[model samples]
Target: MVSFLFLDFDGVLHPQYDGEPTPKEVCFCHLPRFEAVMRRYPGVQIVISSTWRQQFGMLQLRAFFSTDIARRIVGITPTYPADGPPRMHIREWEILQWLKQHHASNKQWVALDDSQGDFRDYRHRVVFCQPWEGLSEHRAVQLSKALQGTRL
Candidate 1:
């Protein structure tokens, strides 16, 4: 089965100190560790679940990552309403919508986010990260374990 990783930026990337950042302020603090771990799981593809994707669009958003990581991104989660006010409780809904569109129920998927949000039944697929630490070494290890089809 295909393996998918739903990646969040703010808290999960670095730290969500002052809320949403401008394009220039987006610092990839722990991206090196993230890349080190991801290198071991070449089959896993990333789907941006960050609000950045909703704000910046794919072309600009992909520019945030290094070339190696950028190549692994398959897509971003769909925006709410197709147009209009952004929907609340989007992480869970967007993921399900994307999965349905891709016919990807059988794929192994995981989300790396600081807030639990409304994961609901998909809680088992999450690898909770600390906002202050971003993707720490321990967290990356947990993700690697999950990607290897093992319990973290």
Candidate 2:
């Protein structure tokens, strides 16, 4: 069975800060380490759960990663409709919606994000990243361990 990986760009792939960022804190600076871990899990497909998806086309988003990894990005989560009822854990809701829409609700899945509270109800499926450090060495290890423990 294929597994899903819900991905957030800011605060997960790079530093998320209120102040001006240093030159070294460029976007996707930590992607190499993330990609390294993901390489071991070929069965895992990615779904962008980040706000970046609202600004970029699928092809543009995929361009950020290597060709191999980019191809594994199956899709992006749909944003909640403005007229929809109020909801907490919106990101989690979006992921679930995607799963249902794709008829993949039975697939094993995990989300990589820095906003822990956003996935409070589904904490088990989230591998939280540090906002300032993004996918630091520690977060990378955590991701590996999470994947190893997953059904995938």
Candidate 3:
């Protein structure tokens, strides 16, 4: 199956650690765990579902990861001008919009996000991550199961 992952960086990868003057890289405490899952599932393609894609653009965003993970990134989610304001959190809308463009009906997909809002009907597809813990072993197990078409 050609599975796709809609990735969120701030919460899913690590905590936002709001206003602490921390460098961006300092927030990523779970790359090894994340990388382990990615290594286990090399077939799954990644789409940038994080707002960081808007801030830094694709190339720079991909630069945040190792070269191997970078190759798995198929694309970034689209932002619509009609959706209004750059800072607005219309992420679920953007992910769905990107899915629409890509003909997603037959695809297996999942979103890793920290927020509980904004999913609507697609709530079943989300695997909630604990922001404070990042991609802990427990959440990684959840992610793996979700990708394997097991119960979320």
Model 1 clashing residue pairs (backbone): none
lDDT of 3 by residue, 1-152 (tens): 53899998876777756645336666667777787788888989999887688789778988878899999998999976675765434667888788889998568788888776757677888888876656778889998888887864
Q: Which 10 successive residues of model 3 have the least lDDT summed?
A: 16-25
lDDT per residue for candidate 1 within 1-152, as digits (tens), equals: 33899888877778777565624555787777777888888889999988788678777877877888789998988766767566555687888888888999677788888777647677778888877667888898888888887862
lDDT of 2 by residue, 1-152 (tens): 33888999888889887555535649789899989999998988999999889999999999999999999999999998999998778999999999999999888788999987687667888898888878999888888877776422
Off by over 4 Å in 1: 18-26, 82-89
For each candidate, the alpha-carbon lDDT, in order, equals 0.79, 0.87, 0.79
State the lDDT at 87 in candidate 1.
56
**Candidate 2 positional error at 126, Å:** 0.3
Residue 35 displacement in candidate 1 (angstroms): 1.2
TM-score for candidate 1, residues paired by index? 0.85
Q: Which stretches of candidate 2 lie over 4 Å from their true place?
A: 19-25, 150-152
Off by over 4 Å in 3: 19-25, 80-89
